[model samples]
Target: MEFATFILAAQRGYHQSSESVIRNSIEQAVASEQAGFNTAWFAEHHFNNYSLIPSPLMMVAHCAGLTSTIRLGTAVCVLPLY
Candidate 1:
């Protein structure tokens, strides 16, 4: 079976910085690739802490260079927000 991971990039509390959340998400993608995962999925959200990534496409682009083999995709994109 193919393995994959969903990166929510959630900040559970105010104690965590936005920068760290995004950074950790990127790291997760890289780690997932190294761990032989088939794909890494990112969540997109705006104006809320549910998910810090406003654009999963941007996240994928940022991670494209960090990972070599694992596929990257967005769990969902709210086009109306754009």
Candidate 2:
């Protein structure tokens, strides 16, 4: 038997990342397929100092390019907040 799991990614804050952090996250997503994740979620935010991910869809697209099995979505994309 097996249980499905979501692989969540974050732009929790811009201060938490650098050039390598961004590229590494995508690599991590690709690796998640081997770890058995069925989906991936990205955080969406704007005007926040830490979270620089403005578009969840773009994250989804990037993840889609990296992984073959995981579906991508927004974990908490507050429209009014962005």
Could you give the C-alpha RMSD of every candidate to the true structure, in order shown? Answer: 0.9, 3.7
Q: What's the residue-level lDDT of 29 in candidate 1? A: 98
Reference-based TM-score, model 1: 0.95
TM-score of each: 0.95, 0.65
Task: List candidate 2 stretches off by more than 4 Å.
Answer: 1-17, 80-82
Looking at model 1, the pairs that clash are none
- Tens-digit per-residue lDDT, 1-82, candidate 1: 9999999999999999999999999999999999999999998878999899989999999999888899999998998877
Residue 59 lDDT in candidate 1? 96
Tens-digit lDDT track of model 2 for 1-82 = 4434433434555565645555756666677677887766666656654455567777778778777776667776777755
Scored against the true structure, residue 55 in model 2 reaches a CA lDDT of: 71
Residue 28 shift from truth in candidate 2, angstroms: 2.1
